[model samples]
Target chain A: MKIEKKDVEYIADLSRLELTGEEKELYSAQLGDILSWMDELNKADTSKVEPTAHILGLENVLRSDLPEPFPDREAILKLAPQRELDFIKVPKVIE
Target chain B: MNNFETVIGLEVHAQLNTATKMFCPCPQADYKAGANSAICPVCTGQPGTLPAANVKAVELGVKTGLALNCRVNEISIFARKNYFYPDLPKSYQVSQFDRPLCEAGSVEIDLKPSGSKTIRVARAHLEEDAGKSLHALGSRALDYTLVDFNRCGVPLIEIVSEPDISSADEAHAYLTELKRILQWAGVSQCDMEKGELRCDVNISLKAAAVKELGQKVEIKNLNSFKAVKDAINSEIARQTAMIERGETVAQDTRLWNEKEQKTVPMRSKEMAHDYRYFPEPDLVPLRIAAARLETAKNELGELPRARKTRFMKDFGLNNYDAGVLTSDRCLSAYFEACMKEAPPSAAEGEAKAVANLITGEFFARANELKVNPEDYLSKTISPVSLVKLAALTSAGKLSASAAKTVFAGSWGTGKTPEALMGELGLAQVSDSVQIEAWAREAIAANPDAAKDFKNGNEKALGPIVGMVMKKSGGKANPRLANEAIKKILAA
Candidate 1:
C-alpha cells in the first residue's frame, strides 16, 4: 500500500502534531518506503502457519484482585505539567 | 410516525466490582475520594510500566457473558484503542475489538400485558475506565478542566445489543432486565447514580417500505434509565419529523440535556477521533481454560429469569409478586430463608403469606427508610421473625391490618411479632364469647342494618361487620366478625 501525503497529514493531526508542508512530504515518502520493505513478507507462503498476535506464546498472565494503595500519590500528581490542589488541570475539553 | 418505525440499541458499561484497578495494584478508589488519590505508575501511563490483567475481573466478565447466554470465546485479544482525551491518562485504552470475550447472546425482556421478547446481544467486551473530568466546580466555570485520576483503570465491560428494539419502552425493559441479570450474577452492583453503570443509546427512524436503515444518531451522557428512555423518544420525534419533511437525518452524536429534556448536537469536531485499534503486545492473549469456565459457571448459580419462573411455579406466586420478590438477589434469598422457617405441611399458604408481607409491608418499610429490601432484611427483622409474623396472620391470630401494625412496631425494635401484637393490642379478638358480645352490641346499635341483613340484603352486612370491627378496636378477625354478625341478625 502507498502512503500518501494526505495520509501522513491525517495521522499527524490525530497525534496532535503540527507538521510543516516539507515535513509532511518527508514523512509520506519515509512511510511508503517502510511499508514497501515490510511488504516483502507477503511473498512467503505462510498459509499453513497460524497468525501470531504475540511471539511470546504466553496466555492468561493475570494478577489477583487484592489492592495495595500507592503510598506516594502526591509524587505522581506533581509530575503533571499543571496541578491545582489534588487535580491535574488541562485546557478545557468539553467533548 | 405511522410510516416510520423507531430502532434503538443500547451500549451499557458496568464497572466490575473488583478490589483493585484492572491493570494495576492500586485500590479501586471510592467515588467520594480525593482527586488523584488512587494513581499508580501503570494506571497513570508512566513510561516503562507494564499492565497485568485482573483474574477476578475476567472471571466476572465470563460470568456475565454466561448469564446473558453468550458464547464465551476461549481466546480473546486486548487491543489498544487510540484516542486523545484529558480523562484518559493513557492515550490508548486497552479494550477488546474484532475478537471479543463474549458474542451472540440474547437477553429476554418482559414486555407489557404478559409478553416477552428477545433482544440479541452482539458482543460484550472488557475494557478499563477513564478518569473523571470536571468542567465546572459548583456554579463557577473554569478555563481549564479539572481531572481526577482516582477512577482511572477501573475495570468495565461494555455490553452491546443489536437494533431489535422498536420503541422506547422496550429499550427501558431491556435495560431493566440487563441490570437485574448483571446484579444477580454477582458481576457488578450496576448502580447508575454512583456511575457503576452507564449507558449510551443509538437510535434511528426508517420507513416501513425501506430495506435500508436511516442514519443512526448516538445519544450520550444518560445518567439514568429515565434519561435513556426520554432521550430515545426525543430523538425518535426529531428524526421522524425530518424524514416527514423529505430531509435526510444527519448521522451525528448528541448529548442528552437533562434540564431541557432534549438532545442537542455536540461539536462536529468531537467525532473526528479515529480509534486505531491494534493488539497490545504488553499483555498476552486472555485464554479461558476449561476449569476457569467451569468455575465461572458454578459461580453464576441461577439467573433472574429462571429464579422468577421457579418462584411462580414452586411458591404458586402470581407473576407480579414473583417478579418483585426475585428482583434482587438478597431479597430472593431472604424470601427463601423465610420459607425454610415455615413448616412443610403448610407450605402453600405460608408461601403466599410470606410473599405478601415481603412484597407489601417489608418493601414499603424498606422504601420509607430509603434502603434496599435485601439490605434491610436481616438488619431489623430476621427471617424467623418475619415468618412468624406471616404465620400469625395466616392462623387468624392477627388481623391483616393488625399484622401490618405489628410489623411496623417490630421494625428495628428486635421485638417478636407476638410480643409486639400483645403490646400494641393488635392481637385478633378471636375468642367466641368476646366476639359474640361485640357482634350483639353492633346489631343493637344499627337496628336498620340488622333489619336489612335479616331481609337478605347481603351487602348491608358490611356496616354490621364494620361496627363489630370498630367495637373491638380493629382486633376482631374480619371473617369471624362476619359469621358472628350473621348469627346475631338471624336470631
Candidate 2:
C-alpha cells in the first residue's frame, strides 16, 4: 500500500506529534519506501505456517500472587515531574 | 415510540481479588492507603521494566469464564492497548485484544414476574487497572489533578456482552446477576463503592420499519447500579424524543450526570482515541493446562444458579426466598451451616423455618446494625444458636413474637436462645391450665367476640386471642390460646 500525506498526518496526530508540510511529504515517501521493502516478505511461500506472537516458544511465564511491596516508595515518587503532597500532579483531565 | 425498540449492551470491569496486581508483585490490598504509597518501578512503567503475569489472576479469569459458561481458550495472548492518559503511565494498557481468555459465554437473567432471558457474553478479557485521577477533593476544586498509583496495576477483567438487553429493567437485572455471579465465584468483591466494579453501557435504537440500528451511544461514569438504570432510561427518552422530532441522533460518548439526571455528551465520535492494539511482547502467551482447567472448574463449585435451584428444590423454598438467600455466597454458606446443625430427621422439615429466621429476623437485625447477615454468623450469632432459635419457634416452645424478642436479646451477646428467652421472660406458656385461665378471662371480657365465635365466626377469635396474649404479657403460645378460646366458646 502507498503511504500518502494524509496518512502521515493522521499517524502524527494519533502519536501526538507535530509535523510540518515538508516533513509530512518526506515521511510519506520514506514510509512508502519502508513498506515496499517490507513487502518483500510477501513473496515467500509461508501460507502453511501458523502465525506466532513470539519466537521463543515459551508460554505461561507467571508469578505467584504474593504481595512483595517494594521498599522505599518515596524514592519512586521522587522521580515524578511534579508532586502535591504524596500525589503526582498533572494538568486536570476532566473527561 | 411504540414502533421503536431499545437495544443495549454492557461492559463490566471487575477488579480481581488477587493479593498482588496482574503483572507486577505490587500489593493490591490497600487502595485506600496514602497516594503513591503502593507504587513500584514495574507498575509505574519505568523504562526497561518487564511484567510477569500473576497466576492467580489467570486462574480467577478461567474460573469466572467457566462460571459464565464460556469456552476457555487453551492459549490466549496479551495485547497492548495504546493510549495517552496521565492515569495510564505506561501509555499502553496490557490487555487481551483479539485472543481473549474466555469467549462465547452467556448469562441468564430472571425477568420480572417470572420469565428468564439469556444475555450473550462476547468475551471476558483480563487487563490491568489504571491509577486514580482526582480533580477535586472535599468540595474544593483543584487547579491540577492529583494522581494516586495505589490502584494502578490492579488486575481487572472486562466482561463484554452482546447487544441483547432490551429495556432498562433488563439491564438492571443483567448487572445484578453479573455481580452476583462474580461475587459467588469469589472472583471479585464487586463493590461499586470501592471501585472494585465499574460499568459502561452501549445503547442504540431501531425503528420498526428500519432494519439497521440507529447511531449507538456509549454512556460512562455510572458508579452504581441505580445510576446504570437511570442513565439507560434517560438515554431512551432522549433518543425517543429525537426520533419523534425527525432528528437523527449522532453517535457519541456521554457521561451520566447524576445530579442533573441526564446524559451529557463528553466527546463526539471523531475525537475517539484510536487504541492501536498489538500483541504484548513482554509477556508470553498464557496456555491453560488441562490440570489447571480442571482445578478452576473444581474451584467454581456450585454456581449461584445451581445453588439457587437446589435451595428451591431441596429446601422447599420459594423462588424469592431462594434468590435472596443465594444472592450472597457467605449468606448461602451460613444457611447451609444452619441446616447442617439440624437433626437429620428434622432437617428437611425445619429448612423452611431456618430460612424464615434468616430472611426475617436475622436479616432485619443485620440491617438495623448496618452489617451483613453473613458477617454476624460467626462474629456475633453462631449458626448453632440461630438453628436452635428456629427449632424453638417450630416446636411451639417459643411464640413467633417471643422468638423475635429472643433473637433481638441474643444478638451480639453470645447468649443461647433458650437462655435469652428465659431471661427476657418471653418464653411461651405451653401449660394448658395457665392458657385456659387466660382464655377464660379473655372470653369473659370480650363477650361479643365470644358470642360471635360461638356463632361460628372464626375471625372473632382474633380479638379473644389478642386479649389472651395481652393478659399473658405476649408469652402465651398463640396456637394454644386459639385452641383454649375455641374450647371455652364450645362449652
- DockQ leader: 1
List DockQ for all candidates. 0.84, 0.78
Q: Please give fnat for model 2.
A: 0.90
lDDT (CA) for every model shown? 0.89, 0.90
User: RMSD, each candidate, Å?
Assistant: 2.3, 2.7
* A1-95: candidate 1 lDDT, tens digit per residue: 69998999889989989999999989999999998988997888999997777889999999999998988988898899998889999999875
Off by over 4 Å in 2: B268-273, B343-349, B367-377, B408-427, B441-467, B470-474
Clashes by residue pair, model 1: none
- What is the RMSD of candidate 1? 2.3
Listed in order, each prediction's TM-score against the native is 0.94, 0.92
| Best model per lDDT | 2
Model 2: which residue pairs collide?
none
